[model samples]
Target chain A: MKIKLVFVSLVSFVAIAFLIYQWWPSPERAIKNRLGGLAKTLSVPANDGDLGRVTRVAELRHYFAQDVRVRAGASGPEITSRDALLGLIGAWTPPPGGWTIEFVDVQVTLGQQATSARVYLTAKVSGHDARTSEPTLDAREANFSMAKQDGDWVVTSVEAAETLQRPGSQD
Target chain B: MKRLLFGSNARLSLLRAAVLVVTAVVVFGYVLLPVRLQGISMLPTYRDGMLNFANRAALWWREPARGDVVAIRMAGPRVLYVKRIVGLPRERVEIAMGVVIVDSVPLIEPTVVYKAPWNLPAFTLGDDEYLVIGDNRVMAMENHDFGRATRDRIVGKMLF
Candidate 1:
C-alpha cells in the first residue's frame, strides 16, 4: 500500500507540473531578465550628447524584432524588416530628445506562449525654444505584442499614441 | 477544538492536482493565442481585436498565396509581423508617388487607396524573399518594399 501511494503521488505531481507549464510560463522570468538588460542597452540620456544615443538606438534596430510596423500618426504605416530598422534610422522621427519607457506592464497566456505588454514612453522632442514657453514635452503610450516562435520571442505589433495629463500635452 | 477535517495525505494530493491544471492551461494558451494574433491582421475582413489560429507548420507542406495574410519573424530572437502577399518571387512591382505598377502594367488592386509608381527600382525577390504590402499603401516601409521577405520569417497563414 505504501508503494502504491508513492506511485500515485509521483504521477499526480508530474501531471500538475505539466499543467503549470501550459497555463503560465515560470520560465518567462528569463525573458523578463533579458528585457531589463535590453532596456539598459537601448537607453541614452537626452542631452546635447543625445545624438550619439539616438545613433546607437538606430544601430540597435537591426537586432530588434524584424516584424515591426510603425503606424506614423495615421498617415502611412511602415512594415520594417531588418534593413529598414537599421539603415533608415535617420529617416525616422522618433519622439524628440529621445524617448524612454517610463513604465511597462505584461500579461502572459501560457498555452499560446505569448505575452502582451503595454509600455508607456516619455519622449522629449524639440519644439520652438526656451523663450517660447520652453517647448512642449511629448509622451506616448504604446501597446506591444510578443510571441514565442521556434524557441525565440519577437515583437509582433505596436499601437502608440501620445498620452497627456494637461491641455495640449498630447502631440 | 477544530476538527481535523482533512488528513495530511488527502490534502497534499489535492493541492498538487490544482497546481498541475493551472500550468497546463497557461502553456497551451500562450502558444496558440499570440500565434493567431500575428496572422490575423487582415482588418475589416478579420477585424483587429479578434483571435485567429496559426498553423505554424504550414510552410513545410505548401506555399503562400497572392492574398494570404501571413505572420513573419524578424532577425531578432522572436519578433513577428503580419502582412498580405502582394507579389511573387521575381515579379516587378513599383509604387511611384502613390501608384502601383507591375512590369509597366497597373495592378488596380481593390484594397489600395493610392497606387505607387513602378519606376522606384527593380529588385526581383530571391528564392527566400516573399514580397508583401499592407491593404493600404502610402504607409509602405523605407526599403524598396518590393523586395524579398525571407522564407524562414514566414510564420503561418491566418484562419478565422
Candidate 2:
C-alpha cells in the first residue's frame, strides 16, 4: 500500500511539473512584448515643434541600433546612416491638425541563433492633410530586422514589405 | 471506507487517463499533425479556412510520389504551406502556357485552373529537392512563391 501511494504521488508531481513547463513564458514571448511596446510608442506623433521632434527622434532612436538602415517605401532608397534617417523623419511636417498611427498584427520570428529576429507588422496611419482637410487612411506592412545588443533587442533595418490590400483588387 | 477512496478501481481509472493522454500527445505530435489552410493559393481543391491532417507515418514507409499534396515548413514549423509536388528530385521542371513540364513531358493536370499565362524557364532540382506548386495557377507567377522543397523542409503528405 505504501509503495502504491509513493508511485501515485510521483506521477501526479511529474504531470503537474510538465503542465507548468508548458505554460511558462519563453524568451521569444519576451522579445515579442518588447517589439509590440516599441511599435506602439512609434505611432505617437511628436511634430508639435522642434522640442517635440527632438523628443520623438530620441524615443525612436532608443529602439534602434547604432548603425541602422531604413527604407521607407517599396521603392525608396536605403538610408544607410542612423543620423540621416532621423533627419529625414524630422523633415516631415505633421498635417495641420495632427495624425494618429497604430500598429497591428505584429508577428516576430527569432533567428536560428536567437541573436536576431524579423518583425512583421501592419501600420495604420490616419489624419487630414494640411492643404486638404480630407481624412486619409493608409495601411502598410513594415518588416523590421532586429538585433540583440547588451541584452536588449534593437531594430537594425526596416523594409516596407507589402501593402495589406492590393489597390482596386477587392475581389 | 477510507481505503475505498483510493482503491483499485480509482487507481485503474487514473492509469487509463494517463495512457490516453500519452497516446494523444505521441500521435498528434509525431504521427498525424493537424494543419490549417490560410490562402487561396490552393483554391478549388483546398480552399482557405479548411482544416486537414498530414500523415507523417506514410513518408516514413515510402518516398513522396509525384502529384502528392505535401505540407512544407516555412519560417519554422509554425508556418506551413500546402502544395502539390510536381517535380521529383533531380528533375527538370518548367512552366509553359500554363502547363507544367517535367523532363520535357507536359503533365496532365485535370484540377489545374489556368487563368494567367506562365512562361518560366526550366530549372533542375537538386539531389534532395522536390518542386511544389499550388493548384490555383490562375494567380500571377510572380505572386506565387513556389519552388524547390528540400527533403528536410517537407513535413508530410496531406491525409485527404
**Best prediction by DockQ:** 2
* TM-score (C-alpha) between model 2 and the true structure: 0.63
lDDT for B9 in candidate 2 is 82
**DockQ of model 1, rounded to 2 decimals:** 0.02
Which candidate leads the pack in TM-score? Answer: 2
Provide fnat values for all models in the order shown: 0.00, 0.00
The global C-alpha lDDT for each of the candidates, from Candidate 1 onward, is 0.50, 0.75
Which window of 10 residues has the lowest lDDT sum in candidate 2 chain B? B72-81
User: Residue A37 lDDT in model 2?
Assistant: 70
* Residue A136 shift from truth in candidate 2, angstroms: 23
Q: What pairs collide in candidate 2?
A: none
Residue range B38-60, candidate 1, lDDT tens digits? 22224445544356655455555
Q: Write the per-residue lDDT of candidate 2 for residues B77-137, one digit (tens) a residue.
A: 4446688888898888787878888999998887776547877778777788787888888
Where model 1 places Cα greater than 4 Å from the true spot, the runs are A1-35, A38-171, B1-50, B75-78, B96-99, B102-105, B113-119, B140-147
